[model samples]
Target: MASNIHYQRADYESGLDENSPLITGLTGRKPELKSRDGTASAMATFGLGFSIMWAQALIRWFASPTEFQPAPILGPDVIEPWRLVSLRIFEALSVGVLLAHIWYCVLVPAFPYLRNFKATDEPHQFTLDGRHVLGGLVALCADGFLNCHQYIFMWNANSINRGVWAKFLPFHNHLSSSRYGESLLWGPPMYVYFCAGFGILGCNMAKPLRKRFPDLSNAGIFTIIWCIEFVMDFVIENLAIRITHGYGYAKTYRPLTLFPEQVHQFPIYESVFVASLGLVFTAMRLKAYDTGRSPVEAGFEIWHPSLQGTVRTFAVIGFSAGAVLIFYHLPLNWLGVIGDCYADMPSYMKPGPVE
Candidate 1:
């Protein structure tokens, strides 16, 4: 009986095309394709984002008369000259990375071999790969989702401000002048680059863990991803806060933070919830790739071939954005509103107007 079952399974497998989405999804099979190591791919993607920053900073340094100002130890109460330069450089770099990533997505269709360049071994879809585009869209949506609450409570109460760069960044005195406005402009793309890099890292990390412990369930893998993301967030956020003094967490619950009394207060929960952004983005992309259709794109087959491409594109964005809202933003917003506030918070820790 066992031999008969084994023979039947072999026969069934041999009959299905390895590249067919139907077989891949039904049998829980990953597409057979040459791929690079996940860690290396993740690092490359991440490095690209930072490379853009360095390139921009170098150009700005040479082109303009601006000089690099040393960051003050006590932390500036306002947007110091150095801080403004740092913010401008970083924001422009983020925009540059966004445009570059978008261009890569556009080129992927004409050059399907780009799949080999990403973290996955999965074969490219017939046209544009939804997985590649999903990361940025989700980040964009998640930014909007979290900002809605931050704008209402934090910005309105002046509990948080963009420091002094608001008036100085390109569009002076316009809606884009505010910190939130700048965030609205550049934050999504920054997050997209972040998620693309880290999300792939999480997926790559999971492969080894799964091999070592075959019994580990999906929940266990996700918990591991969450922990790694938390650590990454903690390290990155602290560096940004300490180095640039661009922004600080002023109203955080004291016990759940590092250096809560200092100007660069680091809220533990900020990392705790925000870490899920990459985790969810990775999971969604993997699931969609494995299943050959995202949950939101279920009825995609009914559309005509001409229109199906457009439908699929919207579906990918909608699915990913919705997932981010449910998984990352909802919980983060709740914690931000309830967990981060303290009425007696020190004035020095709070951000002053961007003069």
Candidate 2:
């Protein structure tokens, strides 16, 4: 009886009494509780159910079916000596950057005891009331899946290459602009990175292991997420060049087919989706820290005490910008690097001509 009485009193105090208009009025502003308000606002912002409407719109706007150009038949052994050397040099530089990140991020701090380690849990981190990490993941999945489909069409058009899955990569042409002669090297690698790296990162984030490591405090889930994001970009874009082209062991690198304008728009959708996802996670990290959790306690927190909130605010902004810059500039960078290398090569060994 006393328990029931206490419950009734609490209900009244929280504005849940039968006569309280706050309880029934849909638009009235009631005294907001953190959990309730946060949950409501998050759902409003990134509701899983709500995204479907927009997803369909994006599909309609972007996924235009188009014919592709046929690929030229060429053998790897036919590649000139100087062009081969240039590609090797570029590969070495990429490998160096990736190796450095692994040593610093994975080996240096996490070695020996393997301290602060955890996979990211999407359901726990991205619930309607939780971090909404899943919303970001869905965006990535959508961007990746659609881009892959588009590439599939590109691969199909080339009589030289097999169907989508049969070729190592499809839509290799859409990676960079055809503005300069540099399109040869830049076009394919970029999308390969998007397809392969993001594919792994997305898969890792959605893994069951990530779910088991629910508490962010015990491990650096955010760092893991960031690293995965970076590496996948390299793999899908850079290394994918080798995979499809068959460098080192392969006989040739040739475009299977060219993608039309519509499919090339993947970067726009991917940039938006990933940016939104990162923002939601940053909010969660801040929310956890705001509750007096230390960076150590809030495993996702990446800054020190004095600068936690401020740093995160900036980092989120920087990361969002970085994503845009990457999507915008990487293709350009790849083009320049590839072209400069090509231009520097002897005229007899240029990409368009062979000795």
Candidate 3:
């Protein structure tokens, strides 16, 4: 049976083969019949992220097993009122910085949509290939799973951060950086986001949906994928978090978090974040393509991005991460758990007067 998409004989000279199974119709990259290259190259880039997350988890597990766990009891709330304010500010900044890392990775290759001027610029053509997909996976791990630089100041309970600025967001202050189980939970967000958002939607599932319906256009296909990704992310993550933390219907890990209410709903928040981001980029790219604007076809240009794009990008990422932090600490700011996390440390962990 002839395929709906026009396929071409392999063109060895230019290193393209439209005849291959991976001839994608996603955003950008079009020369009438350019081969999207072997799907093997694209597919191979995935799953490496899951491995990296666990590998880091193992290294931390064996070499620094307890390092991921909470610090010992500290002097009960002796850190002083002013210091807590400072700590909160620093931690928020850290979150924003880390989110920027994630934002750049997934949004850059798809940057054509951020353009205000629709003029032809050959130097900056944005195309999604094997490299961008693989690179995105790595970035998600570094920023989303690993806590960015949360490890920099993680020492012992007594003195986690020696430097003046280190007091805020000490390793013990966060959950994922402390416990093995929590760390595992952190790994899934990015892995699920990339795998479902990009890999499955743009590749594995797009074809079948198109075939069964016959009337589904690329836009129709994308909308279908977007909805599916959001639902799957929400359901899968909630189960994974609940199982890894307790495996039963009890408050096993609720004690692990400073705010149980916020923790329970976090899976829903993250699912929306990832899903919306994927669609935003897709819509932007599609707009550019529809407008008949092409990417830089030649030399590298100045590489300037629009202010609106920068603001909008950060807004989405900021809300995604910031909402969790705010809710997680709202209870902490009031009545904190005695030995829950470093943020709520018991006596002895603080250097001030002993209780």
- What would the TM-scores of all predictions be? 0.57, 0.27, 0.33
Residue 315 lDDT, candidate 1, scale 0-100 = 52
| Superior by lDDT: candidate 1 or candidate 3 | 1
Tens digits of lDDT, candidate 1, 1-355: 6666543223346565434565345444332231211222232333344334334544553353322221112233345567556666655766787776665655564456674665554544533233445535443533433333332112211212222222222223343212332243345564565566566667788889889888999899989888988888888777766655544554555567677566676667778766776787667555656656544455555457786655555555554455555666566556555654443222333322322
| Prediction 2 TM-score vs. true | 0.27
Query: How many collisions per candidate?
Result: 2, 9, 17
**Superior candidate under TM-score, 1 versus 3:** 1
**Model 3 lDDT per residue over 1-355, tens place:** 4667886566665565555446445436554224332222222223333334435644554454344343443434354445444434433543453354344444443554434445544344323322233333333333322222232112123223211211122233443233212212233334324432344344456667779879878878887877876787666646543322211111112343423443232323345555655554344333334433212111111123453233223222222232223332222222232222333222332222111
Residue-by-residue lDDT tens digits, candidate 2, 1-355: 6666544344555546666664456435443332133222222333333345335533542342221222332333344455456555555554454444334433534342333455533222111111122222232322222222111112111112211111112233444211112122323333222322343344456344358777654246555655556544434433433333322101111221112122121122223334334433443444443453212122223335565433333333333223433443334333323321111111211122110
User: Candidate 3's C-alpha lDDT?
Assistant: 0.37
Candidate 1 weakest ten by summed lDDT? 152-161
**Candidate 2 regions with alpha-carbon error over 4 angstroms:** 1-77, 112-355
**165, model 1: CA deviation in Å?**
16
Q: Which stretches of candidate 3 lie over 4 Å from their true place?
A: 1-129, 141-189, 192-197, 246-263, 278-355
Error of 2 at 166 (Å): 8.1
The alpha-carbon deviation from the true structure for residue 104 of candidate 3, after best TM-score superposition, in angstroms, is 24
